[model samples]
Target chain A: MEEILQLVVFGIVIGSIIGLGSMGLTLSYGITKFANFAHGDIMSLAMYIAYFIVVDLGLMGPTVFSLSFGWGMFLAIAVTIILLAIFSIAIDKLIYKKLRRDKSNIVTMAIASLGVGIIIRAVVTMFWGPFARNFVPGIHEAVPITGNILIKPDQIFIIALTIVVTIVMYYLLYHTKLGKAMRATADNPDLAAVSGININNILAYTWAITGALTAVAGIMLGIQAQVYINLGFNLLLPMFAAVILGGIGNPWGALIGGFVVAISSEVSTAWIATGYKPAVPFVILIIMLIVRPRGIFGSNI
Target chain B: MDFLIIENSYLLLTATGVMNWFVGFLTTFAIFAIMALALNIQWGFTGIFNFGVVSFFMVGAYTSALFTIGPPGEYENYIMGFELPILFGWFAAMITSGIVALLIGLPTLRLQRDFLAIATIGIAAILRAVALSTEGFVNRARGMNGIPRILGDVVSGPDYKWVLLAITLTTLVIVYLLVEKITASPWGRVLRSIRENEETTKSVGKDTVNYRMQAFVLGAMIMGLGGAIWAHRMTSIDPEAFNDLFGTFLIWTMVMVGGNGSNKGAVMGAFLCCTFWFGFPLIQESLPDILGNKVFQLREISIGVLIILFLLYKPNGVIPEKPKISRHL
Candidate 1:
């Protein structure tokens, strides 16, 4: 019973991370029409930014509301998201825009995204020297929820944060005018353009929101697992599995898909070896592909 | 007179050593050239974006190594412990990887364009994950070592490398001719047509899936052969050795830099990349520890930057893919 609860708690945290990280990928795929391989690296970049702020800037000494990090990490996260959004736009303008102008195929853009990822990975290694770094120095003790159930304060913080973010995101998607415009644009770009929607504005918003969401995922992952050069790249597969499992281009589907992948991966460890946990989602994905090519809630685009 | 004589002998020895390094460099180039050719058949000829080259290559290496290497003895325990013929091992590698490709390609081919890349990357990771964790398969983490060399016993030392070079180059020439022949055939035209526009080709009655599957399997077979050659050269095998940068990304860059649609361009790009990929290790030995490692990593960055720059600046590559004459024209 204890192990199951522990795994479930861990699963939720991981699921939220996947959900947040993959929100950007699915959004970009919907609006931009290609998977940004560099998004994973961008997440890594965000996590590193947070780490640098916490460690290098001496935000390491304080505690806030039972969490190890303080205001500096929060400030760093804000800065990271803004900078990452701007960076995404710059990359689009510099690299992808040319391909778009030339009417290049999706494969070209995808490969270009890979190139972008490689460049970032190289930059990270060059700067950080290819070693793993931790955000907080030591391990935090878990508090008992009951006789059998114990969870960390950070874990609770993560769950609450995820829920708050999800509510805000849901409200933004359903209630806000800009959100409707974004949704309309994603549904039918040609029609949206015909309807006089500012496609460029939507694209920019998409980039910014995607960057922000990707950042959150990266930071959360860093908190759970140590931040390394390959942090984002390693998650790339599972994130993709989630996106595809939910059906590409559907954000809500991606949210659900994230939980599916996270839970399955965590649960399967009882039978499958721990090292092969990553493979569990992959097997699920392949089976999903065979049974339902478009995914559960995904409409074939 | 004694000092002068010593200097002359040192210069002579250095010359011989550098010549040996050059020979080894050429051999590395040949193996990469085979991979470039295989990738060309897939991406260049058929436009099937395959990012799982490393997985197939690893499979090939292990399969062939398993076929030929003697029993694991006391230290290592592995499946199919036998000492088969060299040619048989190489053949077995191709067949094994080819079948692996076919099984994976069946359901995935019908998906959207980049999904293939995503799916293949997943598949490759799963493969690596399994290889790492499974105790029964290839002895898990320690990896199979001390595999018998292909022609290590018969030809030896400096002169034997020349024999190895001759053999490697001969294979390259044969693969080049075979690929050229296939690309020149009408069937090749059909494949190119699909690349130009899959839906249109399908409308015109070509079995696009079959052709793609063919390209994928054939290319995988070639990659396997490349892996087999690599294992033999190293006299060992490891899951880590067949990494993306070394196996998939590097070869893709080679094809991209060389000219994806052009066979000769693929071969040309392989030689150029091999110069950087292999040449650096030799130079690294001469440099200070930290500096050498940094320079080594810079190569990866350069490849990444190169892909972006090329895509932005030179999409057709160093040797531009010649526009095929359409039958309608």
Candidate 2:
């Protein structure tokens, strides 16, 4: 029971990060109507950005908010979000816009995105030299909840942040006129155009918000674990699995799917070897694809 | 007089260098040509999107290496090495790779194009992870190295590479002719029809899934043959050698650039792109100090830019495959 609880807690922590990442992917896919393979790389890039701001900037020591530690985390998160948003917009203009203009096939676009991903990975590798870095200092401290069951502060923070972000995203996606317009565009771009929703503007906003969410998820992940160049590359498969399993272009389903993937994978480590953890999501993805191609919560818009 | 002689000699020397470079380019072109033709049958002909051709290539290389090197009977670090004749080992490697492809294709062939692509990538990733795992088969990350060279002892060392190159080129030519004939036949026409509209082909009583599987398996076999030839030429094998995304991406790019659905275009694309890949880096390295490093970076950037440009501007590739005209009537 203790081990199970411990595993569940740990699973939830990572699951929250997966949820956040999947939200960004789901939003982008909903708006763009194409699966962005480079989404995971964006997460990695944002994490690296936050790492630079917090650790390399030497902003850890000072206390700002009357709390114990300084507001370095907030600062890092803010800067990362801004950078990621700008990066996404730039990517839209430089790479994706051209493909869109040409009316490229889905496969061509996917391949182009892969090329972009390779470039991003290579540039990151060139700069960072394939090493892992951490943002927070003394992050290993664990609070003992019970016998053989301990919870880390970072994990608690991740869960809390995930809930807060999900609530905010739900409100923004449902309550606002802009959110309505976004949904309109996603439902039927042609009809949305007829209804006076600017397709390009909605897409731009979607990219910006998605980019910010991706950055926040990256920072949270970095805080929990560590940041590396291949961090996003490693997560790409599982994240895709989560997205597909939940239903493509459905943010709510993505959140649930993330937790499901995370818990299942972690639990499977007990029965199967740890090395096969990545395979768990892929197997799930295959099964889901065969059994329920549309996914659990997916509905045609 | 000395300056004049040196200048005159420089032209001759450059001519010889160009000739040698062409020879090297042709050798590589031949190997990739076979693989590209295979891809044409799958993607261009049957519309089966396989994003994991490299895995089959890796299998082919490893299989041939293990067989030629004999059983690592005493060497507990390495697994699966049975001493066998060269021809038999190469044939076995081809068959094994085909079987692996069939295994992967069986479940995945029913998927849509996008799902198929994702599944193929997953398989590639799994194969790579298996290769890298320490406890798994093939000795973890250390990789099998130092396989025996086929035909090197029979022919002189310097002459052997050229001889093997000739053999590869011949095989490529044979494969190309065979593919051209096949694609022009009634069966090939059905594949093209399937590519254009699978539903229409199915309506016409064609089993599209079975046809796709056939194309995929045939492509895998050709890729395996290429891998066998490459292993013999290099006489070394490693998991890392095949792990890079370039292995699959480069082949796809070659196919796209040459002209999908055209064997001639596939051959041309493989030869030209590979030559540029090998030669451009050398030229970059040879440039004067300030420009040399910049050129290398530019080369990397150009690859990404070119892929985008090609997709946008020349979706059909440089030399589009011409529709076959029947002369029988």
Candidate 3:
């Protein structure tokens, strides 16, 4: 029972990380109407950008609150989020904007994003040299909350951060005019345009927000694991699984789906070899596609 | 006279080496051409989004090897060494791939296009995970080796390379003609209709889903055939060799560059892309250390850039699909 509980905790930690990534993915998909294969690589790019700030820039400050990374890492993450938002907007202007003007299908956009993903990965590899590195380069100690229920302070921080981000996301989507505009555009681009909502502007804002979310997810992933070139690419499937599971365009669905996927995959480790953990989410994804293509929450933006 | 004779001998040897290299190049080209043609059927003609091309390729390779590798020795710890002929293995490969495709496509083909893409990516990842983790199934990380080579008993050395090249080219030609023929038929027209508009096709009483499933399975089977040929040529199999980037995305690039919906374009794309992909590495050797060290990465970036540029500038590719004209025209 304790072992199962421990596994569940681990699952939830991983789930939150996946949840964050999926929310960004779902947001992008909601507005763009195409699955952004590059979203994972965006996360990877964010990680590298943060790594540059904290490590390459020599900004390693003291570790905070039993966490593995320092204030420098936090600063790096903030800067990366802002930079990534700008980057996403720039990319939209450069690549997706042209495609959108051409009125290409969603599959074409998806493939283009796949190409973007490849380029991003290659850039990451070129800069980082395909090696694993940590922000602070030390094993985070796991503090036991109960019998055999040990959790890392870093893990707790990740969960708390995810919850806070979720709340903020909720507020933004519900309370903000930009968010309303974004949702309206996602619901019906033709209608939105006819109604005098600037589709392009909403798209730009969507990219920025999704970019910010992707960066946070990437940093959290790096903190949980280690920063590596394939870090984001590896998370691609799980994130997609979560997004599809939650509902393609629905942010809340993605958040919930992330936890569902992560927990299922993590817990399946007890029965199967640890290496096959990736398969669990895939199975869930396939089954979900077969049974209910709309996903658990349905595809509302 | 002695000096002249020596020079002639050296020239002869060099000629033979070049011939060997050319043959080897064409052999692999034919293999990829076959797979690209397979992809052309799925994505180009049928409009099926199959991102997991590598899964069927891997399955075909492993299946053929398992069927033809014969019995394992004590402690070898592998299963299903049927000791069958290579021909049987090839058939088995195609059938297995088709079945796998049917299983996956049955549900997803009826859904939105995005579902098929998502499902394929998932399947590819799952298959890879399975192949890597299951020690008893595929010999784990060490990979399956010592499979019997195609025509090993009769052929040797340089002659064997030529023979294998002949076999692959023959298979490629057969497949090209087969798909070409089917795609020109009424059945193919139905597929094209579905690709153009599924709802319209359904309204016309054409079973769009069934047609898609057939195209999907057939394409997967052809990919399997290509994989079986690849496995036989190498006489070994490994999970790492079937990386999605190489086996899947590169094929996609080939199909797109060659121009989808054109059989000749697929072959041409395979030829062009393979030459750059394989031949560029040789050029990398002569490059300065700084550039040479990152040649592979640079090539990857170039390919990505090429894909984006093509999508933007020349969406239809070098040889865009020709509109079907009336027979009188």
Task: Report the lDDT of model 3 for residue B209.
Answer: 88
Ranking by lDDT: 3, 1, 2
Residue-wise C-alpha lDDT for candidate 3, range B1-329, written one tens digit per residue: 01111223233358775576678789889999999999999999988989899999998998999999978776665789998999999999999999999988876787688768877987887888788888788787667788888887789976798889888999999999999999999999998989999999999998888999999999999999999988888887788888867888899999989998989889998998888776655555568988876867887898899889989998888888899978897
Model 1, range B1-329, lDDT digits (tens) per residue? 01111223233358776676677778778988999999998999899989888988899999999999888778777898679988899999999999999998998877666878888877887788778888777877788888777687897866887888888888899999999899889988887887888999999898899999998999999999998888887777778667776778889989988997799999999987777666554454457877666765676777788778787788888987888786799
What i-RMS does each candidate reach, in Å?
Answer: 1.3, 2.2, 1.1
Where does model 2 sit among the CAPRI classes?
acceptable
State which candidate has the highest TM-score: 3
Candidate 1: segments with Cα more than 4 A from true spot: A299-301, B1-13, B280-293, B326-329
Task: Looking at model 3, give its docking quality level.
Answer: medium
Model 2 lDDT tens row, B201-225: 9998999888888888888988888
Model 3's DockQ score: 0.73
Over the true interface, candidate 1 deviates by an RMSD, in Å, of 1.3
Docking class of 1: medium
Question: Over 4 Å off in model 2, which ranges?
Answer: A55-70, A136-139, B1-26, B73-76, B134-136, B284-299, B324-329
The true-versus-predicted C-alpha distance at residue A58 of model 2, in Å, is: 4.2
The lDDT of model 1 is 0.82
Give candidate 1's error at residue A246 in angstroms: 2.3
